[model samples]
Structures are given as structure tokens and as C-alpha cells.
Target: MTEQGTVLMTYATARLSDADIEALGSELDRIRADVVASRGERDASYIHTVIKVQRGLEVGGRTLLLGSLLPPLWLAGTAMLSAAKILENMEIGHNVLHGQWDWMRDPEIHSTTWEWDLVTPAAAWKHTHNDLHHTWTNVVGRDRDIGYTIIRMSEDQAWRPWHLAQPAYNLLLAAVFEWGIALFDLELDDVVHGRKSKRELFDQVRAVLGKAIRQAAKDYVLFPLLSGPSAVPTLVANLTANVVRNVWAHTIIFCGHFPDGVEQFTVAEVDGETRGGWYLRQLLGSANIDGSRLLHVLSGNLSHQIEHHLFPDLPSNRYAEIAPQVRALCGRFALPYTTGPLYHQAASAWKRVFRMAFPSHPRPSHPRPSHPRREAAAVAPYAMA
Candidate 1:
């Protein structure tokens, strides 16, 4: 039987008792320990190989595009540069800064030192993503990643008329993801609402601008000028490459985190969560994309996002190795193991964006003692869509 099929069959028969749930946690821990213990030559070789391949593509592509007026060379060079950027940002930079391979003891690859290709500073990303987002997962008010503080992702969020344009802005955000992320790091929502001081926001904005200027110079100014006669073509090529990388990363990330079956939690659901409950929350909050080896690598193995969230510090390469086991655990527990092909998952997430743009049933929220009878505590009267 296929791995997913087996999981389904198991879930058909098993019910999760307290004993079974505790055992499930233990089994997951056992697997994590085993993977942790076995991180050695294989892991090191894998990361080094990816880095070499990415660098080679970047160099070869830029060289071919340099001082060349050939249309075919421009096409090939742009494609190569896109591939290189995607690999560098996703497979290398994202995972490295996740501290996945810190056990390798390589300072160059350590999370503390590595910066990504994107405009968002690595330190800011670690604070918002690693520290806040991961810790909060899908908790509505707690996780700023819900709609990235822009779009209303659920009914729990107080919707404003501006959300009517979210579908449009969502596309825009995908096109310019790096910029959106850099802005997100500044906590612009808080800044505008007086939650964060303007002075502090200004300092953060300066840091982002500094990084942006350096990156822009490297791609559009310094490298293009180095190409001499091909300066224009090279600059345009870099621009296209960056855009492609940004869109692909944004798509893959959305597929993993916001698809149809994925659940969003309220603060109450996660407020007092235990270790096992936290694991369960992560499982429910994440979805996975089914694809070939190439897709997995380009996605930085975030294709196995379920596994990644459960063990965020684990080497990303190890995710593929552990996915089946994780699926089986979900099956044994009779919990959902959400997986879909890339297109399907992407479509599902977008559908949510569109569906949520309109008003809907009241969302489940924790009752505040002061507002025990607030109307959101129960669904409003039904109406045709």
C-alpha cells in the first residue's frame, strides 16, 4: 500500500485514548532522537553539495550573460540565475539560518552569521519567524504571519473595508515578497497603531534600507557594470531572476502553511497547550506539498512543512527521511495528515484568500469575562452565499 493509504487504513480502525496519545508523543520523540543521533557525514555532504551546485549555477549563468548580446544566452542566463537565486535563498539560506546543521560546527553555515538574499534582515526574520511565528504557529492574534498583518485570513480578525482589496494586494505581495517581508519585520501594523514607537520603527527601517541598497547595487549596479556592453541586459536579467525567485518562494511557503485543510487556532486553544498538544497544533496548522525531489530541494524541503514545524531545529534534509514516519503517527492518532500536489495546495490557499474576502459565519473565539455575551461567541443567523 502507498504510505498515505496505510495511514488512512490505520486511522479507520484506531481511536486516540490518553495512553495512545502519550505513546504517540514518545514515539515521535524516539524518532527525533534517532535522527538527531545520526546526523553525521551524510548530512554534511548533502548541504555542501547543494551550496556548490548553487554557486556554480550563479557563476556560470552570470558569466554567460556578461557582455553578450545573444537572445538565447540572455534567456539561458536568466533561467540559470533564477535557479541559483531560488536554491540559494530557499535550500541554503533559509535552512542554514534555521540552525538546521549547526551540529556540523561550521561557523559559515551557522544561523548567527548567515544572511539571506531577501530584503528582510536575518536577525529580524529570526525574531518574527523563528521566535514568534513558530512559537505561535496558527494562533490568530498571536501569530503575525496569519495574513502577514495585511490581509484578514480568518473571521477572527476584525475585517475592514480595505480587506476588499486583499486579493489584489496578495498578488502584489507575492510579486514583491522580499519588500513585504522587510516591512513586516518593522511591525508596521503596530507602528501605525502606536503599539511600537516611531523612533524604533525608523531605526529598523534604516537597517532594511541599508540591506536593500547593498543588494540592489550588487545585482543592478555593480554586476551589470562589470558586464560592460551587456550592462542593460544583465541588469534586466537579474531583475527577472529576483522576481522569479521571490514568487516561487512565496508560492511554496503559502502552499505549506495556508491550504484548505490547515486549521487556524485562537489564543485560547493554544494558551495552555502541553508538549503533545503543541505537537498536535503544529500538525494541524501545517500542510504539505507532494512533488518530486527537485520541488523538495527548491522549497528547502519545506514541502515537508509538517515535519519541519514539529522539529524546527532538525536539519531540513532529514525531513524527507522522517515524513512517512510522521504521517504514520498522524494516522495512528486518527488526526489529519494534510498533503496535496503543488498546484492543488496553491489553489486551495488562494481559494481561502478569495473566500475569506467576503463576510462569513462568526468564528470561534475565547470568551472574555468582560464581554461574555459578545455576538462573535456564536454564529450569526444563516444566509445564502
Candidate 2:
């Protein structure tokens, strides 16, 4: 193995003191307050409308798919179902369940009771994802999402022989990303290492099993059988739709956090962090995807992953509205605002996966970019986190 903690780091050129950090926090809070104050009928209408459309699409697709006797019908049905599942899983379910709309205080949209399309129960996932993953976005060790309990996502995670199969592991995980996330929610390593009690682990298992069984029966069994002789077609179409949703979710998510320029941090980096420090960490650690309005909606507006990380509790729809402001803030701060199209981000993430499969060394530093006003900020890995 190579020496640890030797990576070259970069930071914004605008030199910041503790007072400046607090001022940044204050400015962010102002933006947040504005968004929160603006929340009302429009935000509520957006989510409800999205949910309605998603449900309608799922039903229409299932109906057509159930009776499909030709390839064309099957294809059309599969497309609709795929779109529905994507909307449900990404735009509607994920954001609503984030309690992003919970400020309205409606029972149905409340975070505590919202269940998602994935195999993992919403409660279990929220505990691990919202509470844990968001709490520690790109920290090498503390964030289990760094590699989703499997791949080696950062240099700090020592390369292991098993990681050699990551390309295969990653592909399989993409195919069944929902199941992979469910299993990760259980933190299997904790069970094997005795960090979790047998009773607690089994309880989680039972909850997951219940959700899995329901999901399987709905798409694979009940829906198929309900179609009688057309059961075969419906089953296949449903399976295709689910796979499409899984792969899409996996790709979008991986692109957001694992792309080339996104920084990874150590726990020490965030020790006793203040509000501005936390905001800076989120800005540095997260990446974004450039895309059209439709792409943004279909990706659950997580295409604005940088804004999402910076304001996770804010309504996801608002990410788009506030992205320009956020970008402006990044420019003013001279901080790196990592973003690119979806394909480039995906390629970058995959490249990292392959490169990090084996042991690697710290990246060689080059001279900071030339700037007239000040240093052209080269993003440092953990220097400012």
C-alpha cells in the first residue's frame, strides 16, 4: 500500500478568516429564509401534481402492458412504466420523503410516514441516507455511501483484493441498485463485525423482507396473474421498467458524489465545524450535472447536486430556482463549483472506480492557475473542509 494522507490539497484563492466564514453562513441563511418564506401553494401544487402524474402513468402503463400481444404495445407500455417509476422514485418520492415538503405539515407528505419505491423501508433509509449520508457527504470513512459498503471510492480507503472486481460489482449493483441500497441500509459489515446486535439486525431484516415481498408481488406476481393469459407480457414489461429505474437512479446518484473533481474529506476536517464550515464542506464535496429542465426533473432535481447538498432540506424544485444564486455565491467566494453534463460526470466517476481499484498515490500538484486579481483557486481536497 502507498503512504496515506499524502494527497495534495487545494482551496479557494479568496483568503478567508473565521469572520468571513461566519459571514458566508449568514448570507446562506438569508437565501434559505427567503426560500422558506416563499414556500406555499406553488410548492404544494408542484409535488401533488407530480405525484398524480406519476401514479397515472404507472396505472396506464400497467393496463396497456397487461394486455399487450404485440412488441409495439409492450414497448410503449414499458416506456410509460419506466417514466412513471423514474418520476416516482426520483422527483416525487425521494424529495417528498426527504421532508422537503414537510413544512406544509400535511400528513401524507410528512417525512416520517412517507414510503418510497425502493426495497428499503423509508424509515430505515432515512436514518441511513438523510441522517447519515447527508450528515457526512464525502467523508472517506464516516460516510458509508462513499462506496455503498462495497467499492473503494477514495484513496483513503485502502485498496483490497476484493476491490479488483469492482467493475463487475458496480455493474451488478447498478442492475439491482434498489436491492443494493436496501442491503447497504442494513450495514452488513456492522453485523458481521458485531457492531449491531442480532436482534436489531434481524428486526431490520424483517422490515426489508416485508417491503421486498410487497414490491415483488405487486410487479412480478399479482400484476401478472391479474392479467390472466397476458401475464407473461406484463411480467416482462414490469421487470424491464424496474431495471430501467434502478440503473437510472444508480447512475444519477453515482455521478453526483463520485465524479472526478468532488473532494473527499476526513473526520478531522469537520471536527467542531461551524455553520459556514459545514456549508463549505457541502459545496466542495458535492458535484452537479448540467442538463435541460426535463433532465433536471427526471433526475429528481439532484442534477443540481451541489445546490441539493448545500440546501438538502429545501424543496428540491427550488434547487433549480436557486441554482444561479448558488453559482454566483461560489463565484464570489472563488470556490470550485464542480458541474458537468450527466454523461461526462458518469464517465469521470467510472474512471475513478477503475483507477482506484488498485492502490494509488497522491496526485502530483501543478502550479495554481494564473489569475490577475488573485490566485486562480485550485480546489483542495481536505484543506478547507
Would you estimate the TM-scores of all the predictions?
A: 0.89, 0.90
Cand. 2 Cα-lDDT: 0.83
Give stretches of model 1 more than 4 Å off.
1-21, 193-195, 365-385
Clashes within 3 Å, all models in order:
0, 1
* Pairs that clash in candidate 2: 10-380
Which residue pairs in candidate 1 collide?
A: none
Residue range 1-385, candidate 2, lDDT tens digits: 1125322123322344556666677778788889998999999999899989999998899888877667787898899999999998899888887889889899988787788777889988888988888878888789999998789988888888999999888999999999998999988788889898989999999999999999999999998898888889889898999999999999999998899778877765555455676787788889999999999999999999988888888999899999899899888776788999899999999998898898876443223322223122533321334
Q: Residues 1-385, candidate 1: write the lDDT tens digits.
A: 2333221111122334334545676777788899999999999999999999999999999998895478888999999999999999889998898889898889899999998788888988888988889989988888999899888887788877888888999998998998888888888878778888989888888889999999999998988999998999999999999899889988998887789778777765444344555677788889999999999999999999999999998998899999999998887777888899999999998988887788777564533212123243333211111
Which candidate's TM-score is highest? 2
Off by over 4 Å in 2: 1-15, 362-385
The most accurate candidate by lDDT is: 2
What is the lDDT for 149 in model 1?
A: 83
